[model samples]
Target: MNLHLLLADDDIDDCDFFKEAIDEIGQLTLSILNDGVELMNFLLAEPANRPNLIFLDLNMPKKSGMECMEEIKSINKLKDIPIIIYSTSLDRTVVNHLYEMGAHHYIQKPGEFSNIKKVVEKAISLFTSTNSQLRSKEQFIIYP
Candidate 1:
C-alpha cells in the first residue's frame, strides 16, 4: 500500500513544495487542508479518507495548530494517527507546548529550497520508519 500524508497549512506554495519533495524521495500521496477546521473536518467527518499522517502548521487565521492538536488528540478515534507540527518559527516555548500537547514531532520550516528538500526527506524517513515499526510489531500494515 502507498503511504498517504495530509498537510494542514494555509500556504498553498508550501503545500505544493511539500508534495514535490514527497514525490522526489518516495511514493506517497498527499492532501492539503488550508485551516484547522478543514483539517479537523477531514479527519472527523470523512473517516474513509483519513491519511496516515498529518502535518499541521501553527499561527493560522481561524483555528490554530495548538487548538487542532488538542482536538485531534482528544478524539478517541483520531488520537492514534500521528500529527506533526510544521512551522516557520523556532520558538522553544511553542515547540515545548506542542510537545506537551501531544504532537508526534515538531519541524521548523526551512527558508532555502535545498533545506526544505532535506527536511522533507528526513521527515518522511522518520514518519515511515515509525509507522513501519508499529506495523511490524502488530504484524499488519498500519498505513496504506
Candidate 2:
C-alpha cells in the first residue's frame, strides 16, 4: 500500500533532507508545509486531503507543534490520524508531555542521511502494522 505522509517544519535543510529520504524509501507520497500555520491550513482544508500520517516539527513560527497537536486532538475528524514528532530536541519533559497529548511516535532527527532513511522506514512500518498496539514511552522514540 502507498502511504501518504505530511511533514511540517520550518528548516529548509531538514525539509530537503526529509524529501530526499522519502524519495529513497519509494512507494510513498509526501506533502510538506513550511510552518505550523500552513500545516494547520492544509490539515483543515479538506477531510479527503488528510494524509495517513503526519510528521510534525515542535518548533515553528505563528504556531508551535504542541499547539497544533492540541488542536488536532480536539477535532474529531482529524484526531485519529497518526502524528510523529520529528524534532531535534530530546527534552524528556517535552517528550513525555507529547506522549500524553496523543502523538503516535517521536523521532529525534538523525544527522546522517542513511540514519534518516532508516528511521522513516521504521516509522512507516510501525504505523502501517495491523496490530494497533499501544507502544511504551521507551518504544515511542525512534532512533537511527
Candidate 3:
C-alpha cells in the first residue's frame, strides 16, 4: 500500500536525506514543510490530503514541534493522524513529554544513510501493518 508521509523540519539536508531514504523504500509519497507554521497551515488547509503519517522535528522556526503537536491534538479532525517525533536530540525528558502529548513514535536522526533508510522503513512497516497498535512509552522509540 502507498503511504503518504509529511515531514516538518527546518534543516534542508535532513529533509533531503529523509526524502532519499523514503525514495529507496518506495511506495510512499512525501511532502515537506520547512517550519512549524507552514506545517500547521498545510495540515489545516488540506483536510482531504491528510497524510497517513507525520514526521515532526522538535526545533523549528515560527512555532516549535511541541506547539504544533498541541494544536494538532486539540483539533478533533486531525487528532487521530499518527505523528512521529524525528529529531537529533535524545533527551529522555523531552521524549517522555512528547509521548505523553500523543506523539506515536520517536526516532533519533541516524548518522549513516543506511541507518536512516532502515529506521524509516521500519516505521512505515510498523504503521502499515494490519495489527499495528499505538505503542506505550516503553516501546515508543524506533532505533536504527
Residue range 1-144, candidate 2, lDDT tens digits: 888899999999999999999999999999999888999899999888899999999999999999999999999989988899999999999999999999989999999999999999999988888443465677789987
TM-score ranking from best to worst?
A: 3, 2, 1
Clash counts per candidate, in order, are 0, 0, 0
Tens-digit lDDT track of model 3 for 1-144: 998999999999999999999998888999999999999999999778899999999999999999999999999989999999999999999999999898989999999999999999888877887344466777699998
Model 3 alpha-carbon miss at residue 22, Å: 0.7
Q: After best superposition, candidate 1 residue 95: deviation in angstroms?
A: 0.6
- Name the TM-score of candidate 2: 0.96
lDDT of each: 0.75, 0.92, 0.91
**Model 1 misplaced stretches (Cα beyond 4 Å):** 131-144
Q: What is the Å distance of residue 74 in model 2 from its true position?
A: 0.6
Q: In model 1, what are the clashing residue pairs, if there are any?
A: none
Count of backbone collisions in candidate 1: 0
Candidate 1 has its poorest 10 consecutive residues by lDDT at: 135-144
